[model samples]
Target: MARGFRLIFATSLLLMLLGICNGSTIGICYGRNADDLPTPEKAVELIKNLNINSVRIYDSNIQVLKAFANTGIELMIGIPNSDLLPFSQFQTNADTWLKNNILPYYPATKITYITVGAEVTEAPTNVSAMVVPAMTNVYTALRKAGLHRKIKVSTTHSLGVLSRSYPPSAGAFNSRHAGFLKPLLEFLAEKQSPFLVNTYPYYAYRDSSSNVSLDYALFESSSEVIDPNTGLLYTNMLDAQIDSIYFALMGLNFKTIKIMVTETGWPSKGSPKETAATPENAQTYNTNLIRHVINNTGTPAKPGEELDVYIFSLFNENRKPGLDSERNWGLYYPDQTSVYNIDFSGKGTVDVNTGGNLTTVNGTSWCIASPTASEKDLRNGLDWACGSGNVDCSPIQPSQPCFQPDSLVSHASYAFNSYYQQNGATDIACSFGGTGVNERFQPQVLIVYS
Candidate 1:
């Protein structure tokens, strides 16, 4: 066997043994906001290559459901915001959605959870107000279909749902959001599904890096952020963020619900103004995060419970809106190459598409493309998967040195560029050959190969 394959097989066996020993579950969000991702079938192939056991998608896309069938991977599918209004009002709508989108694929897809809405507290529209009722209705529908026991219903909320989160003990929900969040918390507790949060230390850092320690947010080793009331020291921002949610739940009179971080990541690239965005920082954040999970490190508040975190994305999303950083949180480029190597234990042989010019590594053939096209064009060109659409890896420095620590975004931005230059209007220059998305015009690259 090839050395790489042997390494992969050994690693895979070790991972499987460790998973069995640890019995921890990890979930990844499969957001499809961009257009350059692989088809569901190919996505399944990619996911299998990663050996991730659980995954979450924004919607019950039939193709995704079908693609994942019989794979033994657990899925958590979403009910979009638009459909919430109708589903909340009409049981029939919920029933039809389940019958059409869920029932047929069941037992085959191994779907375990259904997220009724995403961060409803942060959703722009009334999707927040309708979430509880929508969840209830959806739960009822699942029950009617005799699938409620197997599938749990829940909704994700943003950290914005909290009124104060500084001291883990003093955490409380916003008065305004309480009316909506209380009932939802009850439903989750009743169903025993986790309370999900999309926590971003980046936002806090960007809002006020002066007050927020870059070290704390970036998972750098440092003195803990002490929660005065509890007198606990928090070594990582992710734990503090989650404990804040837990404390918020306590304030609402529901303290037992499990809290899970549904999404969290560091952007590998960003606009000039986004100081913390960089490849090196991204690597540190993810690498530390993986180590944290592997060690089963919990927040100071929840010392024993294992944290289940899905990094923001598998690939940098080229088409997401807002700052240039918004689109660059992926761990890989569209061609299934590592953006910067971190251990994922993703080595396997599979059928390759011979139709296109492809790079055959193992049995998988990945397309080699640069993210030279505009974000819109990339989105249009690729099927809309969160990390699939834009930005290229082909132009990066020597592919052989996949794990070169310096070329990463965090090091490139913070260590290489001056503080003034980080926030300056100077167009980003490529130390390597490729372009990363920035504010003015974000370019995306999507290459699809079986």
Candidate 2:
């Protein structure tokens, strides 16, 4: 009888597992603070071409929503820091926002999440207290519109929320933040939403590069950092950073609530103070990160569970304030070119000689499109246009392909291939000849091709 019961339980669990596997989604943050950039329509085409299915914009720009229409990209739009005050005071404001910025674009644009305030609690300003209430109001508005189930509500937090994060097990929120954080966590758990976090190991390294192992922070081979309480070893800084959040959640008694890395990335360049921020290190960190995501490997605390992640900005925002690193977190430049090389599994390509649509080529289809292509090769193709020669086509070329050294497109191409190897595109093979081989043109901004 016990054996029969065990088998029944296993079957039920199997069905649940299948459901998650079939519907899991990956997203990217689309922070648009740059002055010179592509229009929303072109941006949508870029993302669609890359196969990125999800995006999180910092605000509800109508142009962006209109661009995403019928593209099937799952959007997560936000209420900016300045709007939180008015939103907290009036539920009507929330409702109006929905009617104005959301409802009009729904189903057609496919908005799946609405962040009330991104990293407000972690901000140095006094708006911290308004965050939770604003989120509540936003959730209420969504429920009123019958979008609660389709669109979850939450706010992103910075690592500044943590008071103690060393030894992993001892992670806890700053006592000052707990007043609002505790209740917010409760709301998230009840609503079945994830706790979003923006983590940057580059920040940690930049603060004190001498003490930190560059390889460790870059997600490369290193001595494991063990959690004092659990005695579990972590080989990568990302897992360690994530587990810190889990520990904090556990301390608040909301252990069951899922934690998502809404934003995590490395900068490609920086000033003297942020010297650790370099192109090579950025590639290493991101490459390892994508592989970690594909492998679905969890932290020491949750070994098998897949962690949801969204990389930082799609393009560098040159106009953003703060240190040099702030503008350098972009994976690509303003023109949709790559900043470094990294490969992502399930986003690579294979060449076939059979005549077929160019869009369906194994790796050509952007798995994460509507904004950024999910596969490394296609992303490399985009970068190749801008002359970011991060893609090393040396092996594939019959002779040395004349890459424009100063061209951003060349750098992007190299970065894409580098990203693939760093991520998990271990089995991908490049095709030299195919039906559309001649037509498969990389982006040529004239400097390289002309």
Candidate 3:
């Protein structure tokens, strides 16, 4: 059984990879703020199964680093904000960190980048001050270890660094942050490393939904916002955000430095006040985002340029502190199940199938409880399918025509199949904690059973 499952998983991954051919590669941020996440080894397997070739972790956990070994997935490891002070104060600290956290893995793990700090500008002034020096020290350590050429070093900045963002051509760094940003930009330009920035259109729209159109935030805007200064027509907020960084760099005469979006995504759920945060909206945002980035049709300011982007996260973090939206940006649930179906390939929507030799199914099918699954798991999955999933369970009610069997398995099978069909009819849609299975069935067959 395990061997069959592995074969199906491998074939599905291969099909996904084929669909992404020659398109822009996308990366995911793997944040581990939730306690329910799977082990690193399992997590790596899930990532591969999804055909994601790149990942960025907040820190270099040894278990995760070991799991990544031999996986051939490109990684961007990070140095947390708390470590910046010590790393900047002493080169020895940086060298020691490298020797312990990075040297042992190296080429085997495919570590391509090391972020010195994440959104350092959002930290205290002193911690923010350490960002550039820490990056310099880390770069020096990599050079001494003969790994400088292989690994690029930099820090991630928030969009807050820009004092003026509208009319992207006029974008400039906030004066208060200039003292730190000036030298940081110089080092990045000199080292030829890319500037990493986290840009979220969700926040912009959340703060002023009345002013910002939902279509603009989700990359579906038909009306354009023309920048008066440069006359560039902006269709989406993300592009404007990216170009603002470019103008800021140009202001400092660092025209040649490249920019990479380190983090960006929409939440699948949110508090009542967060009206725009919904699973459908997240699906639209991410699907459109993949198409936009992979098209390699860069922003209006930088057309036809290849830009690297990493989605904000992989799993919803239950323990993350902030608004409900903070914990809901993940594309997957803790069980590695997709929150909604999405095609990472630039191609059109494709169903996620995990059945060997059955890549595509045309006939009607129904999701039913797997005979081998545990009772507890089935019940839990049934509750979720009927509750949060918003699947209508009316057909399986006690007095309903389909409720004659009056068994947990029977009712659950009906509910599960209903939810699955309402979703994308994909393998993930039927994966209710491994308790559901897809089976081909005719309407007459179900009618006879009824």
Please tell me which predicted candidate would have the highest lDDT against the true structure: 3
TM-score of each: 0.71, 0.72, 0.72
Q: 389 in model 3: Cα distance from truth in Å? A: 54
Worst 10 residues of 1 by lDDT: 413-422
Per-candidate RMSD, Å: 19.7, 17.4, 19.5
Q: Write down the lDDT that model 1 would get.
A: 0.65
lDDT of 2 by residue, 254-330 (tens): 75577778898888888786767888988888777876665445567755344778888688998999888889888
- Predictions ranked by lDDT, top down? 3, 2, 1
Q: What does the lDDT come to for candidate 3?
A: 0.80
lDDT for model 2, please.
Answer: 0.67
Model 1 regions more than 4 Å off = 1-23, 345-450
